[model samples]
Target chain A: MIDSINPTAKTVGMLIGSIALGFTFHWQLNVLLSLVCLLFLMTSKRAKLSTMVRVLIPIAFISVSYFMTGWLFSSEQALFSLTNETIVAGGRAELINGLNLGTRILAFGMIGISYSLTTDSYDLIVSFIQQAKMPMKVGYAILTAFNLTSLIQTEYEHSKLAIQVRNLPVKGFDTKPLFTMMVRMVRWSERLSLSMEAKGFSEERTMHRQLKIKRRDIAFAAGFPLVILGLGMILAR
Target chain B: MNKKELTLRDYLLMALISVVFGVFYLLAVYAGTALTTVLTPFGLGVLGYEPFYGIWFMAAIITTYLIRKPVVGIVTEMIAALIEVLLGNMFGVIILISAFIQGLGVEVAFAFTGYKKYTYKVTMTSAVTATVLTFIWTGFRNNYLAMDWRIVLAIFVTRLLSSLFFTGYLSKLICDKLDEAGILNSMQTREVHDR
Candidate 1:
């Protein structure tokens, strides 16, 4: 269900909705939204338990750190003094603010993870090209580059190994190899473009794959923000 | 200088460069996250993360330099942000906004140069412009105004220096090395021949 929705809509909707929700500073509302997002993730077929765990671990760490920071460093007045003299300001407002910030971060992460796990990168690019009217040449080039990531990673590893084998002076922060790799990749892109041109790739080309927005996609695209906004309003009150 | 449409080669180069710097950006995010966690207790939470802010703009600056195009910086940064989101960045959808602003900052800087100059001085000026623009945007967005003035100042200064170093000095250095390797000249030659 999540995968079938237009990526551009999902991305734009989630971005706009989340940014709107983030500024609300209502901890309860944010928490409810985050839980709803988590429920969505849990129900999605693409979101595995392991993936959830991997994503949440960082969110948990960040939330904890945010809470700690807000508690300790917030300039708000102290609601109550702690027993420890070093512990200066322990305020209810500050604690709530921390929770709000942390949970908001988690909510944002959850929304992102849902989009990423469900949406294919190619589909996203295609949606950009088709729906958002991005230039086809630029879209295809981005697709090519995206596909080349693993290959580039492999080459980077190989270069590192080669440097090790040759016993080169592996100084701290050595960027020479990086620059060389970049230049090489640029050259490869040049060649690739030449080959593509030879094959008659041009501005006006037909796409074989068709992207249609189904009824379910419309429901999802419209329903998500409305539901979140409703819940936010209710909870804020 | 005659304006030319970007070729497939230019787009691909932008992508390639974005991918390379995207990795650096991912690492910087990790480092910034860790430092923010470690430093938050000392009231230096936001300031601690300032240094990593400029690394985000490196791809945009470097790509603009290499491509010497008007919107390449914005496009490259957007692509990089997409990749980051795809890679499961915790900031998620908001990364797009950050990337857009950062890219626009560099794009505006280049625009000030009439998209003609790619000098070290121009690069530095662009970096500073981008840094200041982003700083202001983030400050307003994240409610940094509520924070103590000292922390805000520290963040601003550190972010400026970091942007200057990574996007300005470091990107220029890499482009110079690429030029020295004759790869840039070859690409230029191919572009001329194709034209």
Candidate 2:
């Protein structure tokens, strides 16, 4: 169901919702928002459990960091003392602030994962070209580059092997191989552009893959943000 | 037609480079998360995470340097942000707004040079401008105003220095290497002749 929705609408909705959620400082509201986002992800048959787990790992780390740091550094006045003496400074207020930021981050992550896991790359590019009115020249270039992912991976492995054979020190963050790979990729991209021109690719031509906004797309585009807003308001009180 | 306008080749090159840097950005995000986590207990989380902030702007600077077209920095960074979103970035769609702001900042720096200089000095200037703009924007967006001024200042300084190193110095080094390897001669020569 999610896969059938228009990628552009889903992305725009997510962008609006996430930005709105980012500004709020209420932990309870953000937590509720995150739980709703998670529930949506869980219900989406297209959203893989493994992908959700992968996305959640980083959010988990981020949330912990936000909670700890916000509690320590937030300027909010202490709501209570940590010990018999006010040794630690920030108290309940800081904790709430921290949790708010942490859960907001989690909510953002879940929304991103849901969209990416379900949306096809070709559909996304098409939607941008058709719905967003991105320049065809720019859109096609991105599509070409996106299609080169496997080739890039192969080149990376080859470069790594070549480095080993050349006895280059495989030390920390060696950028030589990366730069060499980039140079090669740059050359390839130039060739790709030339070949595309040779094949008569033009901006004036319309894309064959037509992007259509279905009923589900409209429903998701309008419904998701409203749900988030409603949940945030209800939970804030 | 303006000869300096970006051609199809320029777009392809920018997109390819942005795709490569998109991978690097993802790795940096993970490293940044870990570093932030480790430093949070010490109350230096913001400062500790500052160094990775500049990495995000590298693609824009490098793309601008390579293409030398007006607004290529912004376009390249936007494409990179798009690729990141497609890769399921933890920050999601917010990356798009951040990228646009950072790209605009770089574009401003290049414009200050009259779009003529691709020197180390200009690169550093662009990095500084981008970092400062992004810092201010994020400060407001992330509620950094609620933090103590001392911590905010610390983060600002650290972020500035990191941008200098990553986007300015390191990018220049890479460009120099590409130049030495003769990979950039065609573009530079064309640019010089155009000028």
Candidate 3:
């Protein structure tokens, strides 16, 4: 059932991207890896500009945060001080620091996107618990955690619409409507849980559908380390 | 073995609350970037994230304050946060680590109450709890909070106000609203309603 998406794409993208991230901080290396992954987006049978936007948007924050934290300090060692109000030191050191920090985060987001792009949601969970050695029981417990990214949006929208229909003053930080939604969601979880058990969930341990570690998995895992070593070498030189 | 086992219904409620808290947090997080830029000068900057995000603390308070238990808040909030991580927050492992610390702050309120009960005092306690614990952690993590005492004090005061106003007050307001709707009639809401 989970094979509905580019099941291999996420697996490969994440595997390669994660290795690239782990192996090197060399600007060229990371940039190459990012561009390669971006090419997958370009050539992707399914990847879109919207996905690019969604993925990179989170990166912007991480990048900006790195700059703010790395450059802005109370020290006289200021980088190119912008009238930016925040204490950002302006210079080569500061610039390098920003790039270093920003690339690291950009890699993180890129890896995340690549993973999401290639992997099915269900398989991702399965691999984490089964292969990664996380407790399966807790994994299943986390399965209940799925509603956050999915149907809850509909529920929140419905609640907001309900308020609009009632002509409630749902604006300007009153938080009454927000509060109303919180209680209702808490109330709904109970009902959803009952449905799970009534539908035959149990403590029985049965063999689960497991994913096989392919040659590719090994390649990515092994390659990631080598890349990191190369970056360290570059930095040292 | 005759444990008064929590029913599936109770378990579901826990998950639901976790989900609810998750939604609340997502709102706060998104609202932070959009709102902080505008409110920076007015000192409403504390309402934003970045310098300090208090969602973990707020989530802990909501779940614990309602469940009226000690570890429930900490455990629930942590799990909810892990869900946020799983949902692919870019903060990565750092957020996962922060969640537990933040939850511990709210858990202190429950601890101070001797793990005995929940009340408006406990609510305020947990609010104070979130305030103290989170303020301390953010000082170093955000670096901004770690500045001089004036800045530290300002950050602390800003966080405390956010906790009371957004976390405690908002949580209580939700509890009251749900009661009026009769959905939470099973909880203390009904008891208050009948009176």
Best by lDDT: 2
Note the clash tally of each candidate.
0, 0, 13
Query: Would you list the C-alpha lDDT of every candidate in the order shown?
Result: 0.73, 0.75, 0.55
- Candidate number achieving the greatest DockQ relative to the actual structure: 2
Kindly list the per-residue Cα lDDT of model 3 for residues B35-88, writing each as its tens digit: 655543443333346333544465566665455544666666656655654565
lDDT of 3 by residue, A137-209 (tens): 4455566656454676677667777888988756634456557666676666555655666777655544467
DockQ (C-alpha based) per candidate is 0.50, 0.53, 0.22
For candidate 2 chain B, which ten residues in a row score worst on lDDT? B140-149
TM-score for all models, in order of appearance: 0.89, 0.88, 0.67
lDDT of 1 by residue, A31-144 (tens): 777777777677777777887787788777666655555545554332221222124343555665556556665676777777777677777888888888888888888888
Give one digit per residue, the lDDT tens place, for model 2 in A115-175: 7777777888889989898888888888887777667767776777789898876543457
Question: TM-score of the candidate numbered 1?
Answer: 0.89
DockQ computed for model 1 against the true two-chain complex using alpha carbons: 0.50
Q: Using lDDT as the measure, name the better of candidate 1 and candidate 3.
A: 1
Candidate 2: where are CA atoms >4 Å away? Answer: A77-90, A214-219, A226-237, B1-3, B46-48, B188-195
